[model samples]
Target: MKVDVQLLKDICEAPGAPGFENPVRKLIIEQIKDHVDEYSIDNMGNLIAIKKGTKNPDGKKVMVAAHMDEIGFLVSHIDDKGFIRFQTLGGFDPKTLTAQRVIIHGKEDVIGVMGSKPIHVMKPEERNKPSKIDEYFIDCGMSKEELEKKIEIGDPITRERELIEMGECVNCKSIDNRVSVYILIEALKNIKSPAFDFYGVFTVQEEVGIRGANVSAHSINPDFGIALDTTIAYDLPGAQAHEQVTALGAGTAVKIMDAMTICDSRMVKFLKKTADSHQIKWQPEILAAGGTDTSGVQRMGKNGSIAGAISIPTRHLHQVIEMAHKDDIVGSIELLIAALEEIDTASWEY
Candidate 1:
């Protein structure tokens, strides 16, 4: 199956902070508006779509989720000298904020550069430790009057990096979960006849917390649930081999557990079986740190649903530039299709 390169670029490049997911949601809606049986945007900013099944007219409800939010900052305080101080919307590695370019979504979009004290002027003790995010300021190259006229407090800020194609990988901001959004949209377009009624939910606020998925899952209350997201690929230097979690190009990750929840063992087994039967590249994931929407979906309603996650191996997560391999991206969609095609025979009760 071929992945849509342009769509992937559009999703990754779109600005969608935790509570500001409209831009990304609009793009997703445009792509799958006609493909699904029905779809709607919830009050919590989730795009929930349903695709009916022909094989089992009375089958169970199967829910698939992918979050659309990206880590960013919100303008909190602006100094009289035109320096913009902001608060983080999601998790960030403070070290990565230095020297990065960002766009402030205010009355109008304004480009800004993160500024900090020059290293040459820093004290020996200061240079030894990493600078905190609060210590850095955004420079819009505008005077106090010009900045006050256009920008205001509470505006959202997003990374301004464009998607770049490496030899076999793609690098851009917000790859943490946009890659999965691409996967879900592509899988929905490709999977012609699923075995069970599918509720594909494009969620929000995943980076801040699994709030959107929690509300949507309680509302849908599906029998089976799956969270499509990206996992840490610490295959770079300085990371120990045993703690790599996952590797780039190692294939789609069958998440066993993460910092949030332990995936349903039955679902885990079924996914492995499907991947093997179809000869798809796969790996087991145990995220030592961090979580996903899988946690909220697994324990939503009365009896709860059997839940698991499919993760794309990613490098430099929560940074200005995150990376994912093309093979892993395509492999994730292939595995999702294969699993959905065999959902009837696959047991979820363990």
Candidate 2:
């Protein structure tokens, strides 16, 4: 599909914890500032960019949200032996933290290893039980005084990993929304003439809550919206087919509903029709749990928006090695661009 692997890699690897989105926001602005008609960063760190439409006489606006923040942690305490305790910023499974690497952002970037009780010491009952978040600590291999020189309290900590392609899929740490960020950037570059004024927003703190999207939507008050994010692809060795919400390498996903929002009926139909018309491969997404920035983009605006999402099928979501099919990634960009261009032709009337 001729995907830009390097660009996606850079975006995915950049560190941007919830409420600490500076690094990602800078990278996004560098990639998209000139491509859009106008761009600005809001107080909450959402990067809002716009491109004027060709045929919008009513000044309709379509807001596209792609959250830039990844689930991360904040340093809460540093012990006498240089071990660090942290408070989580987003949902994190404790099992994923054992033996994983993390980068603590203080005066300088300090690498630390996640440490927990050794399996050799665990009792039979404890051996099978899942670890809790409080059981983990960061080991920096330094003394209290030495670690204190380079570290500080409340610094953001992010998972350490690099993006790589594995046959037909790409795997990385922040593929959840960074992949969507890359899609939005590429969509902006490829869009020739949007049907309505395009408001592409790289939202911040979404990993914590829908803070950035909430504020941005209220200000833009868009008539229509499309959120770009990753959805769970549980197509593993499970025995049941219905349990697999989506599948890797299948295609892009058109939103029906998630734990947070039910996509507007018209928007859902429009996305399906657009994909069918363009021959863009797609699958239906009905996530049983977890939500995206769709909640804010759909309802936080003044009059609310006819909003839905174009989801990339992702595997191992929220873990260190999240994966997404290259074909689904490519198809998501195509579907988003097609949806933006053809939005005006849809019968939005309820």
Candidate 3:
């Protein structure tokens, strides 16, 4: 069955920067309340929703996590010309900063455009050199005095890109984990099998670090964990075959290793077997850089528990135009449900 594109769009468009995820948290709670047995928000802003199984209450615990935070900017300084100087809350390519519009969240909403020195107005040496994020400023079309009336330091800023349909794929900002979040929600809605008690965690502050997951994992102490996230798809021109981590439209990605976590092999095999039995499309991923909440959950308690990740192949991650295939998302949800249904607690060790 097809997932609702409008729901995905709404989740992606919601503004939830690191350390500020109330808006997104509320949206998720509303969507999954009926499907879960219990739900609560931790002190660090992680939203945890539980789905109990028919088995014993002391049965195995399974946690599925997706982060709700997106990469954005924070107001650092405002200049005399009403220009806003900012510091990045996460990683950004300086090349992508020119001429982009941003929403500055102050006491009130303020729209601004990223401003940089035009090449025509720059020196010959400067024209050939690439720009740095520090060289950029946001113009809000107000005087310094007037700007103070609206915006202030520590205000959040987000990319001003709208979700759009391109051919068969959907593109928007924050699709990295939002798409994964949607997958988990859809899976929980359709699950009807006997399995361990499940916890769907929508974590915060992931773009800055896996801060929320670290705390949530400790609270749940799950016996098994799966982090739903997005992985890079370097399938564009000039990228080599080996460098292409995964490709869009191929299938859902099962990550073996990334920079932070080495996935549990038994859990990986179990997911793969379930996908095969259910005829779900899937791919294997080995990310060279970056990590996800899997790392935190894998080492939460004494010696921790089995942990792995199911990732969607995404193009232009951390950018305004992130892309993912519709079929891959469906496949991810199917695979997750199948695994949950077929997982044998007696076979697993610790």
Off by over 4 Å in 1: none
TM-scores of all candidate predictions against the true structure: 0.98, 0.99, 0.96
- lDDT of each prediction vs. the true structure? 0.91, 0.93, 0.87
Q: Give the per-residue lDDT of model 1 (tens digit) for 12-119.
A: 999999998999999999999989999999889999989897687577788899999999999998888899999998899889988889999888899999988899
The candidate maximizing lDDT is 2
User: Candidate 2, which ten residues in sequence have the lowest lDDT sum?
Assistant: 236-245
Top candidate by TM-score: 2
> How high is the lDDT of residue 86 in model 1?
92
Model 2 gets an lDDT of: 0.93
lDDT: worst 10-residue window of model 1:
341-350
What is the RMSD, in Å, between candidate 3 and the native fold over all Cα?
1.5
> Residue 283's C-alpha lDDT in candidate 3?
93
TM-score of 2: 0.99
- Residue range 1-350, candidate 2, lDDT tens digits: 47899999999999999999999889899999889999998988899999999989999999999999999999999987889999999898789889999999999999999999999999999999988999899998889899899989999999999998899989999998899999999999889999899999999988887889999999999999999999989999853899888999889999999999999999999999999999999999999898888999999999999999999999888887899989998999999999999999989887
